[model samples]
Target: MPEREPLAPAVAATRLAVRRALAPYAGGAVVAGVSGGADSLALAAALAFEAPALGIAAVSVTVDHGLQAGSDAAARDAAEACRAMGLEARIARVEVAGPGGPEAAARRARLDALRAAAAQVGARAVLLAHTLDDQAETVLLGLARGSGATSLAGMSPARRDPDGLTWLRPLLGLRRGDTVAACAAQHLAPWQDPHNADEAFARVRVRRSVLPLLEAELGPGVAEALARTADQLREDDEAFRDMIDETIEDIVEHAEAGIAVSVAALAANPAALRHRVIRHVVASEFGVSLTRTQTLEVGRLVTDWAGQGPIDLPGCRATRSGGMVVFAARA
Candidate 1:
């Protein structure tokens, strides 16, 4: 009998990555979010291959945003591909309607659909196919927005959202070309979304123009560098969050209308930690994200307090009273 060839390198690499990502969720059901794109198709294929060995029942979910023509058919085809891999599959048709633009609205709707699908299937985690290139683009977007460390940290490998659904991005360390090669090796024809090549979208422009420009201008490894920067920033942000949580427990008090933090404590900490604590408190209490200017203005009530009356903030107001900086609900 003729000997069977070993699995292709790209396929082996993808399966190894998926296996490592699913290790923690052993024996639990997992859902792969497939968009019929090369990245997601590779992810779905790898999950289908690795889940059985990990004792996980894998399911593929395709979300149809209905933005473009034939979207539903594309979603159905993705589901069919998953089924062909011997995994359960589902299609989630979501209505993309919200305040944000089409891209943002579509993303929000797709996430909601994925979470709902995961819950329905009793899956403990949903695997997403956001590759290293995606992370680099995210960092670039954050830089363009002049965001802080948390925003520049990009996406985490695994995160449990407020709704308690665990989201996993197993391909964050893999390159986009790796996924494309994996799909080719598996003989899986991926659907190319028109939006991906549309220059009107900021992400598409970044993917098509800016990234290539950077790679050309500065040689290579720009994406890897950006991804590394995100990884490092994420580690720092996690540590800072831990410190903030501990400090808040000791120094924060429940106010009549909102929350109060000790002015002395705020002033004593380093500037970075102090600012983060202030922002975290406001976000956690009032569900408002303070801009850098707003956060600094509030920080002034602690470090640079004089006889200032009250600083109006989004959804709340900050006032310096005695030894505490009180954030109260705006009347």
Candidate 2:
């Protein structure tokens, strides 16, 4: 066991967050995403310090996006810092293929590296240091996309990856300043990634431009307000999702590319519940989620349609093909 040092407020908060996120999957190793920045480095330190008591170990992983000139050196510095903190650290360099565009390619590459590192260590989960500010940004971005509750609900603290590994964000409730403060309190110099300030990214635009404007105009607590809205929406969305799951157990049937909903069963439900059911079916089966306008279209399909007709959607199409409504991708 490592000697206990007095943890700073930021470090203590980080520790609590990490512990809460991993409580369900006790005693398993956690792969910490270390980007050489203050946020991730502080998270790495907290996890390393708390690991012994929790019966879990922490491994640091630095994904070199290979986009910047000194990215490799930055990754090496990150690994060295992790090693100094008594964590086993490794660097994964990834090539960013641009067919999907640079940002998309880099994101896929980064997650791929993180997943690969977790697999190598036999870790069941990965910890990401996304803060409260990030969550607000996500919510605002989702709003700008005109997407509904699920998109506005933003990221989950713990989500199962498609491959069954878990990805957790322990620092989601804390601010970026807190992470920087933690590094300063520990006498650690954390790197500032230049990309964070670049206006090329929408997130950067929101963080640097929109948030500041909102704070100035709305009086300082706008981020908290937005985050609160996201939290409430998340709760509502989860309940609705659960209802849909249970409803599907009774009302859904296998179809060609998607599922078919029994019109009689669906029509019996209240308007709000029926809307959620339709949204869930579109999102789950055909990977199509209705926007505000699309939701109205779906409502018409249920209530106003006197006869069978088609409703066009992104990635798929919906229609009253028979007595029951069917949603499937167009052949």
Best model per lDDT = 1
Q: Give, for candidate 1, the lowest lDDT window spanning 10 residues.
A: 160-169
88 Cα displacement, candidate 1 (Å): 0.7
Each candidate's TM vs. the true structure?
0.97, 0.89
lDDT of 2 by residue, 40-75 (tens): 998888887777777887899999988888999999
Give the range of the ten consecutive residues with the poorest summed lDDT in model 2: 287-296
Q: Native-vs-model 1 lDDT?
A: 0.93
Best by TM-score: 1
> Model 1, 55: alpha-carbon shift in Å?
2.4
Q: Tell me, what's the RMSD of every candidate?
A: 1.3, 3.1
What local lDDT does model 1 show for residue 216? 100
